[model samples]
Target chain A: MPTGSVQHFLHGSISSNDTLQALLHLLRGLCEDAARGSIPFLDQEISYTIQLATGNSSMSLRARRSLMYEGYPWLLTYYGHTDSADSSRLVAVRTCVQAGTSDELPKFLSCIGFKKDFELVSKGHVFKKGDMRVIISKFYNPVKDPTHPDGYQPLANEYLVEMSAVSPKFCEVLAREMHTFAEQLKPLVYFEKFIPESL
Target chain B: MVVVMLISWESPEGMSPGHANEKLQKKIEILGGKILGKWDVDCEVYSSLNGIVGLSDTQTTQPANLGGATAPQQAIYVLHNSNYSLSTFAILEDNTVLIADSSFDQFMPHMKVFYKKGQRSDAKGNRYELNEFIIKTGVATFGGSQQKILLLEITYLLSDYVHESIGIIRELAKLLLDNSFPGIETPITVREDKKFSPSDLLLQYKALFSHVKKPSTVK
Candidate 1:
């Protein structure tokens, strides 16, 4: 319920590599601190990336990061997403997360009351580009289990959360799309089964 | 075979039909072919050529075909010191070939780059190839989808100048069969054809690169 007690620090810029490396270094320390605490972070899903220009069409200011969502494995990926009109920028990011129970990632994140932690700083624009947006989010408090009724509630994971939004106003758009992304992010615990290791 | 030497014709106009090899390239040129690259089998003679040469579109193309669609072309040189013999068809009957624009083309042909024991250049040990031969033909028809079969021929080539640029022989066979409509995914029935499998070629390629032992299931 307290405000300004825990400030979610973010380093944003039109420059991708610079912003990403700084955020990563900060996240590493933040996760380390959060893990050391009594916070009940069953698993922490951290993902970030940098994107490059798709082709010679330099209309879209080249260097930037696209929609970064939490997923399994702290691995880097360079792929393309396209449609009939234009091709998405080439992106390479690493999604690193600690191992935990399968199908439990979504519930774990929800139980920690992460969605509610965005009440304060989660209202501003994280970053943006042509049809691209980045939103900042965080959850420090844990929401107790309703079924347990009488157990001492655990502290949910407390770490910096910064995500990309497609529009110029990233924060507001993410707040609107939060429900959809929450459903998507919840199953990240089982995302491992989708791609085979031997491919 | 994860890797294979791929050879596309430079141009039939320039290539004479004298040697045993230039025949396919000549055919490709007359047939209006698009030469991707070439896998030289007689690799033992690569020492005479430059370590690696990048040819612009104009350089690779014939005088008439110059200034056409061609990415930067680069040739990789290979050399081997260890003892290994040419792969005979009598040994096996199954293999898978692959080539990749990025990664995960292990089943496709690849050029394995290495630092030869004493060679000064990096390209000396690199083996280039396109293993997956998806021979395809036919166009989409009225009632059916594209009436084409994707045949995969897993082949590999060793670049030890002494050897025939890894797998140039197999590619030559595939190139020669261009007119016959050899499907890229053509199934090589081991029982009927009595030919070695893709896995056998894979091990042979690996053995050329290192001391890799062949698996039991591979024939």
Candidate 2:
């Protein structure tokens, strides 16, 4: 599937693993419908970000390789500077390309004058309703081999719940719809846009 | 899928790149090759951020930089060929090549540190089709108009077998260049193997750039 440039997303986090399990069960029930049935998604991916830091300005590119995807495994996304992290529904110009299973992306980025900044493993479950995707994932720092099951250290004690949609252009209706979806998951986990710099 | 071979021609100093390109196109036409369309390959150079950002070795103790900094910081190259519309990112220092979507070029501006050194876009050329073979003649220019190099690319579109088409391509080059064949330089990746793919063309282009710009000495 072709990814859209305008990415609309809202993020929330649950502290306890018990709450996450309960939320997953609740999500399975919420997303259940007779026509499409209940769709539970398992997402296991490793994300690597490459940065080009000029003395004054710096830019970064991210590549996410899915362990679950056997055929088309890599998704390279470029987040433009126009993206606003402060908005209620965080909007960003995220251009994404689905690449083949070549582990040469990091090599390629390095070839293009970008240095590997960080690497993290994200394992999660996904719930879909229409175009909206609700992802609950945890991030881990790879201690040894990133691809190995036992080769990681948890970054935090919380599971991040992200509701997002990719659109061709900024659509108010899509952002509102995502906000509404976030509201439905409220009390279980409060979805808010947390700025990375502040954290 | 098509396989391509790139040959560099040293056009006479006085002849402008445009005139040289026209001369090659005429020769291809005389050989019963029909002009298919125009094709071009452009390259943009970007420098690394480490030296520019003033990050000392002690402060840059990131795991990603461990052992990666031994090689001197080399400028990055983002190359685009109009025919494939795919972006080929290469660093000639280590012979690393990555093929990505053309839209990847848009992300360059967002990277503050890797400043654009200069760009060469005048590597424009024409594409010709002769029988089952495809011929492309491009003038690689500097500063938009000063043609520096002439490149001849021959593609065998029928199959991926590189050896099978070499004889026919040689025969066509004999006609096209009037038996004065420019040296055919195969990229390191394809030098040993006989199989071919679209990415091979990008690698060939990278080889062309490497010949022109020594990656180690590049600023």
Candidate 3:
């Protein structure tokens, strides 16, 4: 089989809500010609990572399962590392399955025999501009202590801004466009690929 | 990248397990097929999106729901080995395969777990460097229920051509089981007429599990 199209991705973060709003305003003007309406980022999404015991240590063998937007629900994706090891590249083979019912999720996971390791929840919005897709999401970690008023809280103040397209050929062009857009809001928000120490 | 041919072995009407095992073992020994090892394999079904999301109706001019709909027929599954060491994501719609990694969970946010089935089987004879004959008998159950359907799967592994290997496997089965085999004559061709990938093995397991879960006379 055909492996499907290779998706190119660029990651950046805005530290505050004010800067996020400013960047969104700038994008609205830049993508006026090909703007499709906005969609709820992620009303409520829970992500779980399943790992294999004998998978290569250097290379993590994990599959991600997410339930996003109570109305839309199930999305299952498998991620595999590509030949390139460049952290900035972040390329991988992604296989996806869209389930029709909530009942299918557990059955699918059990059939595979993978155990859930860590899970995180997130909420966000998605903006589509022609072939490009942008998501501004805030990830949250569940609180272990029962004393905490809220069951979960934002992992960080920063909001992840990811721009992606399904073609690698569009990487350079998209990068250039995103960079110029970032420059316009430089002082308000910084958008660039910044690798975290843990990842 | 081994090619596989699947043959189902159903015991004659009311034959007991002990009697069936004795006959199968004796036949294999007569054919000089040595037993290699035995283990259990588990399979699970998963989809790309969760819940009852509907796909857009392209025939009409209605606005598309974007990510709000689920396409059940397009769902893919990740089949794991017994120890969960190896996972293969098989896309049934297009027959695509991806060896999943730890980051899979992060990338697939809409993946939902479905049904699970486990099989216990013995490995016999080296068919290829990465291939072998597998005699499997198992039960597929949904959720926490004790109810299960019996399943039998025999796999002949080869890496080169599936059509050719399947013909060889048929002859082997005929020698071992005489007229007892299912005698399915349909050609077992790889999807898209491409060389088999590692994930193709898991596809076989998934197909068998689905069959047991929902048996259809026409399928």
Candidate that scores best on DockQ? 2
Best by lDDT: 2
The candidate, 1 or 3, that scores higher on lDDT is: 3
Interface root-mean-square deviation for each candidate?
21.8, 6.3, 15.3
Question: DockQ for each of the predicted structures, in order?
Answer: 0.02, 0.25, 0.03
Query: In candidate 2, what are the lDDT values of residues A92-179, reduced to their tens digit?
Result: 2334333332456765655444556677777777778788878888877745466655456677878888787777777778878877
Which whole-number lDDT from 0 to 100 does residue A176 have in model 3? Answer: 57
- Candidate order by decreasing DockQ: 2, 3, 1
Q: What CAPRI-style quality would you assign to candidate 1?
A: incorrect
C-alpha lDDT score of every prediction, in listed order: 0.25, 0.62, 0.46
Task: Mark the regions of model 1 whose C-alpha exceeds 4 Å error after superposition.
Answer: A1-199, B1-21, B27-219
Collision count for each candidate, in order: 57, 7, 52
Q: Which candidate model has the greater TM-score, 1 or 2?
A: 2
TM-score of chain B of 1: 0.21
Give a tens-digit lDDT track for model 2, residues B1-219: 656777766655687756877888898898799988998887766555455333232222222111233433555566777876645444344555666666556555555445445445447778998888889998776553443777778887776766666667667766776634654534556643556866666766655664563311111
Residue B9 CA error for candidate 2 (Å)?
1.9
lDDT, residue A49, candidate 1: 24
Residue-wise lDDT of candidate 1 within B1-219, one digit each (tens)? Answer: 123221222113443323323444354446554444422211111111112211121122111111225321222122221112222111111111211111211101111221011111101111123343321111111112222111122233333221332245455545554543232322122222333433233333322221112111112
TM-score (0 to 1) for chain B of model 3: 0.60
